[model samples]
Target: MRAVSLVPSLTEAIARSAPGAVAGATDWCTHPPDLDVVRVGGTKNPDTGRILSLAPDLVIANEEENRAPDLEALREAGAEVLVTEVRDVPQAFRELDRVLDACGVPSHPRWLDEAEDVWSSLPPPATRRTAVVPVWRRPWMVLGRDTFAGDVLARLGVGHVYATHPDRYPRIPLEELRAAAPDVVVLPDEPYRFTADDGPEAFRGLPCALVSGRHLTWYGPSLAEAPRVLGRALRAARP
Candidate 1:
């Protein structure tokens, strides 16, 4: 079955589970290092013409990562679109299973099993701390309300300071975020590519944990290592 995957995590899952099933993917679908599918476009702005030209049997997308108009256009053009909504770890596993089954993968992949095992193996948190997680700078967008990253951090005893905010991603001023006085400030390396030299300076007084964006945000093979990777980073964070 020929499939076009707009989400990078789903692309990797498909490629790893069913080697040659994917026909096209977005330019951002960078996993599987050797993936050679047709480049349709970006997640927010996929090239509809290129996607239709590929004539894929199915297309995979995420509710948050993809635009509704693009998905509608693909469906209007007679493409079978499968949209996934994963807000937490359990949801991610279930949705991955459903997507893989729809793609004709006979059994659960090793990575999925490993991811479940990794998360399950984690002991209860020894300490709990409120953290401010910044996904972007400049305009200063932060993780708020229900988010996959917030859930992941919560599992590791790190709760988001803005998790109760009305918006899923809220744009707040830097001064306001600092004034929130979180126990720690977590920064991921994507969307804004926050680095030690770049991001840590802003929160000089707070303990900063620089984490991998792929492990923190993506919901594919990275889930298997996220618990350990993020756990270590959070543990090592110092004021």
Candidate 2:
């Protein structure tokens, strides 16, 4: 089955599970760096015309990572697109299995099984901390309300202060963020490349953990190692 994965994590999972099943992928789907496929553009703004040209049997996308109009456009063009929504760990696993199966994977792949095992077997958190997780700078958009990332962090004993906010991703003034005074400031490497030197300085007193965006955000194979990796980062940032 020729599939076009619009999400980076899905692309990686598909590529790893089935050698050459993906016929097209977004430019940002860079996991298997050597994955040679037709570049379909970015997740938010994929080139529907180019995508349709490949004549993919299936197109995989995420509710959050992809735009509705683009997916609809693909559907209008006669491409069968499977959009997956992953609001939490359980949802992510279920969607992954469904997506893989739809892409012709006869059964659950080893990586997927390992990923499930890791999350299911995680021990109690060593410590819990309240954090202000920032995804972007400039205007300072943060993880708020019911987000997959928030659920992931909750599982790891780190809770973001904005989880109760009205908006999923609210643009708050930097001053307001500093005023919140969370125990730690969790910064991810994607959406905005927050490095140790770049994002930490803004939160002077708050311990900042620069975590891998793929582990913290993406909901595919990375989920297997996300617990350990993100847990270590959160632990290290404890003040």
Candidate 3:
């Protein structure tokens, strides 16, 4: 069966379910690295025409990634869409199970068990330090409480300094970031593309870590490696 995954998280899930069966993926889809999947624009502005042309039997979407109007259009076009909302780790695992069930693929319980084992093996997070994860540019939005990144940070033994903010990705003033004095500012590679070279000038004076956004924030089987890489970065960035 052919499928199109608009969300990055679901893209990974779809890939894990049936590696080469995913005929289309969003521009943000990077996991499973080099599968010959079709690029159908992005999660926000999916090329509906191009996707329809693929004649997919199933379409995977997410509340965070797929736009409302676009999703409506797809529904009107008679496509069977499976929309998933993954706010935390439990939801993420459930979504993976859903994908495998929908695709009629056997669930990889052993693999998932191993992934959970890895997560459980990690040490408790460093309670003293706080970290901010920037996921956008220009206005400079950061991951707040109630996001996948926040949960991942908690698992890695780090604290979300911006968790008190109401929004998941609120744009904070430079002065606030400076005043907050986070022990480590993690600049993720995608969704915002911040690198070490483009350090926050106000906080460049402080310690920082240039981290792989996927490993630190992404939820899926990839989460298996998160604690190790994130723990290393957090420890090394300590003053």
Q: Return the TM-score for each candidate structure.
A: 0.98, 0.97, 0.92
The reply for model 1, stretches above 4 Å from the true place, is none
Using lDDT as the measure, name the better of candidate 1 and candidate 3. Answer: 1
Better of 1 and 3 by TM-score: 1
Once fitted onto the true fold, the runs of candidate 2 whose alpha carbons sit more than 4 angstroms away are: none
Give Cα distance to truth, residue 148, candidate 1, Å: 0.7
Candidate 1 — what's its lDDT? 0.94
Clashing pairs in 3: 125-157, 126-157
Query: For residues 95-147, could you state the per-residue lDDT of candidate 3 as single tens digits?
Result: 77887678767757555667777866766654656787777767778888688
Give lDDT tens digits, candidate 1, residues 14-88: 999999999999999989999998999899999999999999989999999999999999999999999999899
Error of 2 at 62 (Å): 1.4
- Which run of 10 residues does model 1 get worst, by summed lDDT? 230-239
TM-score of the candidate numbered 3?
0.92
Please name the candidate that would achieve the greatest lDDT relative to the true structure: 1
Per-prediction tally of clashes? 0, 0, 2
Q: How far is candidate 2 from the true structure (C-alpha RMSD, Å)?
A: 1.1
lDDT (Cα) of model 3? 0.77
lDDT of each: 0.94, 0.91, 0.77
